[model samples]
Target: MDNVITVRDLRVLDGRKTLVGPVTFELPGGSTTGLCGPSGAGKSTVLRALVDLLPHGLTRDGDVEVQGQAIRYGKGDSALRSTVVLVPQTPVVFGGSILDNALFGLRHLVRASRAEMRDRVEQALREAGLWNEVSGRLDSPAQALSNGQRQRLCLARALALEPAALLLDEPTSALDERSRDTVEESVAALRGNRTVLLVSHDPAQVQRLCDRTVSLEHPETLALSAAAA
Candidate 1:
């Protein structure tokens, strides 16, 4: 399998303080990889760095490549982000129907008629394990959906873009056991078909969902993690 995203000695710094890494790893195509470490290890920061979305005053060094192309850090280059999408931990729904929320980012990226958009949205919804539940009520207000549904909707929106790799930041952390299981099933269904980097605090969830695991160490450690994940 090919690697969708590759990082070499990637590091994040806020002014003079080293926030994260020197961490390095790659996401293989058609496989799910888990990212786990102690809190404040900069796992989520690494995701933001991949897409050049590092927080204010934080600068990064080292190489980050997507689909064999090096990511340009300057100019807030979101063109790479469009390809390697990041699904933040919190699900944010705009003011609109479920279908509208699904098509929100997708519509801005491509030119298509309404029917074509709906078709893509449906496909994404199905990929996200949300189609069967929302198929009959796509017109319903997004705010009315449960928290789990909202998170899945966010996943659907990312899927609609057909990204090369998905950076899922603690996708199910805030959900209850049942909702977490449901979301895990949705993520499991993507194995061997999509490249996913799932960050989670739960070790069991990581073991269940990921083919391999990458551990990011605290900056104070002598060396960054060397796990070949």
Candidate 2:
């Protein structure tokens, strides 16, 4: 299978210090891959690095390719982010109706007629497992949604753009068990259809959702290995 995203020797750095990586992995098209490690292992940092969203004063090193095209460090642009969208751990809702929230990302990246945009929104909502519940209330205030629904809304927002891959950062960490299960269902449904890179601290979650796993060691562990070598 062709890879949707490829990383080799990827690392995050702060000034002169290494904060993450020397991590490497690949996400094959239509497959779900898991990135799991202890807290402070920098799994989320790697996701941010992939799309050039790393926080200020931090930088990345190593190689990343999307759909076989090399992504030069410090050069990932808006176009690159559109192609490989990141859905952060916290769900962000805008001050708008549900329909508007769903169309947020699409509005910035795609120009389409009203009908065309609606169709895409519907498709994305369905893919994110949210359409059936909100289909009759497209105009409702987005704030009315529960936490789980909001996360799915964010997922739909990304899916509307038809990105080549999704970088999900601990997609269910803040939810109650029921809400987490609901979001997990949405993510599970995406397998075999969308390329997903899922970051989770839950080993069981990874076992249940991912086709493959990439384990990152703690910074101390890496340092110990280096010292031993």
Candidate 3:
């Protein structure tokens, strides 16, 4: 597919108040696209809306099509999430061994023998640039990993699902500079192999990692008349 995702006139509403957009964009297959703006522009909210995960009381209006199929608002839940995964800002390591965490989502999504599942986890960890470091300690507690390792582990978790698109919401914002670089390298490696929409507050970082960008204006800057349309 030339485009993996196509969004048009997307807007988030808080009981009729326009909190996000009339925003539009398309993600070409296997390309890294950045979604960027200053704070309050609802960059993260837009990602949530894409997966039908908007918070309670918040609703979205738009046309979001993935792999050429339209996803009606509030309708694309777990199945949609499996196709277009979102990796949030903070790393979330579940309470379990590193191996458990890696296979967490995969176990639910794929039906396979133990050996097959473990192989998939290994492939995912390698893709996340983490297998070399954790290969000998797969059975160790996940909490023992450093912040950067945890973030990569989360990336591996998502990668294991083999989603068509990944929505990364400031994946490195919570990391230290060193950790940020590591995560950036992992992300950069996926440039031509995965379709990604990255939300970032740092333009420099976006320039370094993204093939192209979609900039969001501050919510206040959107014309009310246009939003009402």
Candidate 4:
């Protein structure tokens, strides 16, 4: 299988303080891989580095290749983000109808007519496991959905981009048990069809949703990730 993303000796630094690894790993195409560790291990930070979305005052060193193309640091944030969409732990709902939120950011990345855009959004909604709940009310307010629905909508928004890989940051940690299950169902649905890199502290969730695991430890813990399962 081919790797959608390849990282070598990736690191995140604050001033001279080494925050996160000199870790290396590959995300095989169409595979869901888990990134797990104790708190502050930089699991989320690694995701940011992969797409050049590292926060202000922090810098990264190492090579990141997306489908064999090198991702130059601090360049083309828009393009890189569109290619590998990141859905944060907290769901963000924009001011608009469900349909509008679904099409958010999508309008800039892909070119298509209104009808075509709707078609793509519809497909994404299905892929996110949100179609059955929101299909009839796409015109309704986006904020009206439950928390789980909101997260799935965010997932649909990213899926609409048809990203080469999806970077999910502890997607279910903030939800209630029932909501978590629904989100888990959605992630499970993507197991073999979407290339996903998921970060979660929960070992059981990783076991349930991922094909393999990558372990990240503190700065002193040797900046290399564990072997893929």
Candidate 5:
């Protein structure tokens, strides 16, 4: 498989505290990789860095490449946003109808016509396991859906863009067990076509969905290991 994303000697520091290591890893195209660790172990930080969402004043070193192109962090570059989409733990839904929310991401694309957008939205909603539940309520407020449905809608929104990769940060953390399972199944279905990187603390989830796992420890320890090598 070809590499879709690469992290070489990546490091992020928040003031004097080193958040994550100068870690090196690769995410292959059309595959799913899980990042597992305890809270405060830098899992979310790594995701943020990948998406160029590192907190204010934090400095990042090393390199991140997506689809063989280096990410120009902090440049407001549209390429990264277009090619990679990050779905954080909390799903943000705009104040709009379900169909409107589904079509939100594609509204600006020149080639996407009204009919195409509607068809794509319906198709994506079906693929996300939300169509049966929401098809009758296309004009209903997005906020009216249940938590699980809302999360799936967020996934649908991301899919509408047809991004090259999707970064999910604890995507199932806020869900009940049943909802979590549903989300897991949806994620599993996404494999082998879209590159997926999941940041999760659930070991079982890691074992079930990921082909390989990456664990990050303290930054100082990683630095020491590099020096020793």
Candidate 6:
């Protein structure tokens, strides 16, 4: 299978603290893989590392490739942000109408026509299972929506860009069961055609959403477990 994203001997350090290291994995195109571990197991850090969004004073080593292209760590942020979109555990909503937020990224790019952009936004919202709820209120403030709605809106925003790969950092962690299910269903629907790397703490969610799962551990602990296994 062709890999959409590949990481080799990847290590991230925040100042003097080593967050995660020497990790390697391949995310095949049109497949879903989950990164599961305890809290502070560097799941989120792994996601950030992929998109070249490691926090301040953090440095990364090793290679991260997307769609067969090796990502240059210190390159422009837009290049990384365009190809790989990360939806954080806490969804960030812009101060605008739901429609505006969904159309945010599209407006800057000249690739799609106005009608196409509108259609795409509508389609993304529907695919995210949020169209009907906000269809009549396209002009309403995005902040006014429920937490679940906001998260879905963020998904729609990411989907609007039609990214090749989506990195979700505990995307459903802040939602109720119903909302989580909705998000999961959306993810299930997105598995094929888009490479998905979901960093989640819920083992059940990992099993449900991923074709393969990797249990990240500290270097020493992982070596010990490997010896035991």
> Sorted on lDDT, highest at the top, how do the candidates line up?
2, 3, 4, 1, 5, 6
Each prediction's TM-score versus the true structure: 0.92, 0.92, 0.92, 0.93, 0.89, 0.89
CA RMSD for every model? Answer: 3.8, 5.7, 5.9, 3.4, 5.5, 4.5
Candidate 6 similarity to native, TM-score: 0.89
Question: Candidate 5 lDDT, tens digit per residue, 109-227?
Answer: 42577998888888888778889998998999999987888899999988887888899999999999999988888888887877888888887787777766677752221111222
Candidate 4 C-alpha error for residue 209, in Å: 0.4
Pairs clashing within candidate 5:
none
* lDDT, candidate 3, 1-229, per-residue tens: 4999999899999999999898888888998888978898899999999988889999988798999999865553667877899999999999999999999988887777899889889998999999999999999999999999999999999998889999999999999999999999999999889999899998788878887778787322221122211
Q: Candidate 5: global Cα-lDDT?
A: 0.81
lDDT of 1: 0.85
> If both were scored by TM-score, which would come out higher, candidate 3 or candidate 6?
3
Report the C-alpha lDDT of model 6 over 107-205, residue by residue, as the tens digit.
864378889999999988987889999999999999999888888898888888888888888889999998899888888888676778888888788
Give the Å shift of residue 203 in candidate 6.
0.3
> What is the TM-score of candidate 1?
0.92
List the global CA lDDT of all models.
0.85, 0.88, 0.88, 0.87, 0.81, 0.81
Clashing residue pairs in candidate 4 (N, C-alpha, C atoms within 3 angstroms):
none
Judged by lDDT against the true structure, how good is candidate 2? Answer: 0.88
Badly placed stretches (over 4 Å) of model 1 are: 218-229
| Model 3 misplaced regions, further than 4 Å | 218-229
How badly does each model clash, as a count of residue pairs? 0, 0, 0, 0, 0, 0
The full ranking of all candidates by TM-score, starting with the best, is 4, 2, 1, 3, 5, 6
**Model 2 alpha-carbon drift over 4 Å, by segment:** 73-76, 218-229
lDDT of 2 by residue, 104-217 (tens): 987888878889888999999999999999999999999999999999999999999899999999999999999999999999999899999889988788878887777777
Worst 10 residues of 1 by lDDT: 220-229
